[model samples]
Target: MSELTQLSPQPLWQIFAKICSIPHPSYHEEALAAHILHWAQEKGLHAERDAVGNVLLRKPATPGYEKRQPVVLQAHLDMVPQKNSDTIHDFATDPIQPYVDADWVKARGTTLGADNGIGMASALAVLADDSVQHGPLEVLLTMTEETGMAGAFGLQPGWLQAEILINTDSEEEGEIYMGCAGGVDFKTILPLEREAVPAGYQPLKLTIKGLKGGHSGADIHLGLANANKLLARFLSLHGQKLDIRLLDLNGGTLRNAIPREAFATLALPQENAESLHALAQEYLAVIKAELAAVEKKLAIQIEPATSDAQALTKGCGDRFIALLNAMPNGVIRMSDDVKGVVETSLNVGVVSTEADRAHIRCLIRSLIDSGKEDVVGTLSALGRLAGAETIAKGSYPGWKPDANSPVMHIVRETYQKLFNKTPNIQVIHAGLECGLFKKPYPQMDMVSIGPTITGPHSPDEQVHIKSVGQYWILLTALLKAIPEKN
Candidate 1:
């Protein structure tokens, strides 16, 4: 065990350390689910797995609180598997090496998985600690939340018997999230026609790197650069002048993450090679100035490239670049109801050119259904104009904030009494499972809270040590404060 297991909340950190030793990347959570099931059973609690692999555990209330309402602790079991290109760790086999850095705990060369891992650990700690006073408790560890709300979507009616659910997935320590935005996946595919490269053409590689990419939902309002869009912009601005013929294009990975790197290779007449390099440098300067504040380390590199002597036909190349450049990205609209919430946004998260086609995938999020449909319609129109096929998938609903929740009142009062300050109760622009859970369990009252986690879904992910202690205190206190059943 590393020093993280020795942190102030030993029980919580200890379980988190064990979690780091297991590989639980999205869509591959069976092992971790089994591990948690075994642990819960060893503690003498009733444990079982749902058809979709969600783990459910039940524990009786403390001696005096058995008559109070039964509360549910909810968290996802999977983590986003992300790492730097050069990191030598494998999410399928290797354990995340976590260590302490001042007031935070971070992983070595990979995402720390603290986003939901810390939440899971806190739940386990609560279950194992017999001293904490609480009513009957149910733990729900859902699967594949990062990729989609698969577990929540497949959750059967009556699977959980609780009136109040405390989701341990929110990132900020002193804030509580009562609602979140809904989202859908959008993909565009452009057929490619390849031909032998012109006899006098030379291949040039263009790369955009070092941008501070982050969660497309959580960080969209931060003004961070999207590398995929940047690369497409560069190609559109200079391709015609350089007589560029695209060979290959690739960038980004997950639909929920803002792209940090992009690369494209193209063929141009030998006479225009020098001009291409000069224009690249000029455009780099402009882009740098535009993203100077948030993306200080943004970089653009141009170099000679050698590959198969084939390139996209001129017509296809022009259409592809034009469509990519025209797609809307980043924040689309801000909420008029909430002071600092993003209402609608989209991220061109992944782009790739394959043997017969070039593809682009985007994640569109909005608080209103009409806003989501508007963005989808716009993309569909662009795809038609570009002669590309478009498809939308993995759509999920948004959690609407409740202004009259008794559980919210209990949590707020508990937090104020503990910290001597009011917590920030707000809605988030990101997706959460609470929305999907509401479909089957319409009567369930829900709120999300967690320790302070930053740079989630990226290699820079970390959890503040001090906040873990505070989060634990607040959760346990909230449990004790659940009012007696009427």
Candidate 2:
């Protein structure tokens, strides 16, 4: 209830809390952007915005550090729009209610947006720190990064002049991320038909809920259950036997977040109602036991539908389930070079059945362009086989790691001096804007690092409060270690 700035010195939490108080969900960031610009002006720094609403703040080098090369600190300004079905928070315009739970800061019943808000907070924190020695600095806060990398894509040529970019977008705290996967979002549409309700039948709805869903890219290889897949499996096993006619189906919402819950409606023989209820309970136990560790809270529900006379069209129900069962989800391949890293993956993230056609959104990710294309090809082929029209959008390239990067070396050395251990350097399976930023600044050297964050892309997302202090320590040290140009 009290204002965010009332909490001081802990600038990371303060700035993050301030950010939370504003509604900056993808494409609706006017008030949040104005907040950012107002803050930048208060610091007496020059802030500029491009036509697409991306903000850039420039700070001249400290007196003795002017000779060093300028560095750009980058983070997306917008967060992914996601919330628990029961939560009343609105993305278009509502404050995020966050609480500290021992080690991490989390929001109530919704995503905390730590994915890049922490990055933005860290940048603003650094800009505000008077003691941290550094050369010239430029902070570029982009808009609408989660829905797509449109904020990065919308940048006109020469918007950022720095050749070195520090992206604070990765989730893990200690590891230094040098490269990341490229990805694309594709959707398929299928025709729908209607039929009269069957006689001597009762309408019923089945649901799968309470899974601990996460970022599809970061959590794909874990073999977590997909709600749509579980629903289809249930239908495949008991549908025909129960004389069930599935009418409506839906699951997931975002292309990047794992589907947490799904439900379907169907008409079934009234005589089998008790048997169906028993089956739902049995299946809940079986699935909970199967995914006990990964998805401890998984649940299943079976309830009578509001209307017993309504039934799904025979044509639409058959094709919809068939399409879901055939669609690919989860890790497609393991990295050949990075040992444990996922090389390629696909997620059938969102599906909606409409009156005329079904719309399905699939996300494909890979560390290489060729591998990404192969996954896309496989998805397209499957969609074609299912008689669905497919559309691919939101494509972004991979950012290849540079082992010999000067800024990377500086960060590594500074980290060792501060923490007394070499930082783990690796390529991530998720997408980062550095991939597209490189297309413009071909010579740009980039690395992504961030405080520890967990359950990103889901309502449980949080940031480690203590890690922010250490992250700031390492960041300032790296800035001081940068080499001065002749």
Candidate 3:
């Protein structure tokens, strides 16, 4: 048996192990979907797929609970594909090699996929376990949630019959999330003008790596370093004192992840090369001191390069660097309603330059619609000032908390009775599909809960071993405690 199969909560861990063996990265879930369909068929459960690739599995009520109302167990089917720059694993072909790390389960140099994978496993285990008592159950597995809410947005009005939704996507084990922040993607594109490399100039590459880039929503409040922003500051600050031309610059991979690495190629007068090297070292020392506590390994490396490529015109380079330095990133506002919770934030997640264009992508999130709009407007103004065109897309609404929700009471009561402690009833800054699901089913009551998952969307991702068992118990108890429909 695999190491995961030996874990406590055998059914859930085993299912998760199987899931890891298949490739289910966002927008590439066909193989995993087929596997799930085959598993449902083998288990003789009624399963169907929606037009947007969402999978729904139905299990009849237990013998004595037939009169109780049906419940929907929801989780996204896709996982964010993130790996260390030096890791050789492929999300498509290689299975996540998860191993026990003391009290947690982590993968080898890549994301563990526990953000929603464990939730998916729990639902599947419930369907397979005849020993567990519960009412009628519907497992709604959505697709491509990491990239965008494509599956949630495409959900039809009648896609689900259950009014009570239990979303198994939240990261904390002892927290029940009733509301989440809404988000929009802001992008800016600037036309680039490249000029022939001036005579007596030499090319050099500057790279910034080792920043602890993480989930833009969950970790933005931690004050981590953004490599893109740092690089821009260095370039802009030094450009004013040196004769240099930017050849190319790029950083980050996903729009929802804080950039951890950045690279820039520049051409400068041969006489200034040694001075540039000294300045880079000086800047590195300054930045290291600024982020020493949070980003210990943060580094700035400069090396010689042999290239004859043209560089961006001085005007364009200066403008681009200035705009980046001025971009708003990290936490914008803290929640006044919920103590210690982030109400609004933005992440400058990606920046890249092509032959004739430079692009900057950011993800903005806020608890209130007005707050979201304000941030978008701010980004637009910045883009306009830099002679770039700005566009916002993939906007989704936030889920509003229902303080007097009947289902919340039941879940709270059940959790306390089982553990002799209260779970934290809270709202998260991260985006959840429960927000989008509310559009078609406005009356649906939703709560998001899951085992403890740390460092999601990064190679350091891990899931607590003991929390999964507690989560399973709580889930089962809540299912059995659901009241009958009037």
Candidate 4:
């Protein structure tokens, strides 16, 4: 029993501790799902799995609250798997190691998984605690929401009995999210032309690392650096002065996160190596000064590298660098409706070059469908010009803000009454399953609320302890205030 279990709202914290012991990365949630099933069974709750692999467990309304309208607590089962380049932990098999740091709990050198794990834990705690007052409650845990809304997409119409949906996926406690942005993933593969390296060419590795990468959508406007974009720019800058051949290039991991590190293996003349090394140092200083505030510890290095593969042909290398440099990244537009909110943005999340092929992955987010399409068109056109294959997938609609939501009104009033402070209600820039639920349960009023979580989709992720207790209080209070069905 760590101190985390001793926190206020112990039920939620204890269950969250258990959740951290299991690996539930996107597309690899079998073990976690099984744990959930077994937990529900032990409590004699009616739990079943939908065809889409979502877990739904029902707890009958508390004795006196039976007549209130049923409510569904929704959260995703999967968490994004991200770690520092040197961390040895595996997302598929190894459990997340969480530690208390002052007011927040963070995982060591890796993403904390608190993004949805804490939300899921809150739902499970409600089912386990018998003394809680609540109307009929259904907990719906979806699958692969981090990689894509797989479970939400396969959700069958009329499957849920709830007339009201309370999504627990939103971060930042006290703020209620009534809507969110839509997103599209673009995967591109540019075929490479290879040729023999020039005589007496030595191999050197160019590295750009230690950038403070964050969520592609939520943190896109923070001016944090992207490793892929930086690597491409650095190489392109010096590529003109010297004819460098790329032996191998790779950077980033998931399309939803800003890349923190990137490196490339190059074949260059021994005499030209010193020039490249000097340039790398120069670029490092420039980058350090550029991102001093947001990205501390930025590092660039050039060291001896080992690679026997042939280097990319000069023309192919030029085209590859050009494509990446030209790709639209960062905030494209700001919301005219919501002050200081980003309306459209793109992240060049991952880029790599194999023996004969170069691949790049990008994520675009927009509050409106048209804005998303515009970026898609620009990427597709860039692909055509580069003679690369571009595939777009996993697109979900954006949730439009609804100011008249009954649940939102109740939540706002309840928060002010409880804490004597008004809560901020805004549409999030990140994608949420709320948009998908509106399809099946069109009439179901929804609102999202959760504890304060920072650095989601990245290794710096953490949850605030005090905010979690406050969130738990607000959630239970909302369930007790459910209105009776007419």
Clashes of each: 0, 0, 0, 0
Clashing pairs in 1: none
Which regions of candidate 1 are displaced past 4 Å?
none
Which residue ranges in model 3 land beyond 4 Å of their true spot?
none
lDDT of 1 by residue, 239-279 (tens): 99889999999999898988888999989999998988898
lDDT of 4 by residue, 318-416 (tens): 899999989989999999988788899999999887878998999899999999999999999999999999999988999888989988998999899
How many pairs of residues collide in model 3?
Answer: 0
Tens-place lDDT per residue, model 2, 271-296, is 98888888888888888889887998
RMSD of 3: 1.2
In candidate 1, clashing pairs total 0
Off by over 4 Å in 4: none
Write down the TM-score for model 4.
0.98
Residue 171 of model 1 has an lDDT of 90
| Residue pair clashes in candidate 2 | none
- Summarize candidate 3's per-residue lDDT along 1-486 as a digit string, tens digits: 288999979999999999988888888888999999999999999999999999999999999998888899999999988888899988988788899989999999888899889999999999988988888899999999989889999998987988799999989888989899999999999899999989988899999998878899988999999999999999998976778899999999888888889999998998888888899889999999988889988888889887666899999999999999999999999999999999999999999999899999999999999988999999999999999999999999999999998888888999999999999999999999999998999989899889999889888899999999999999999999999888
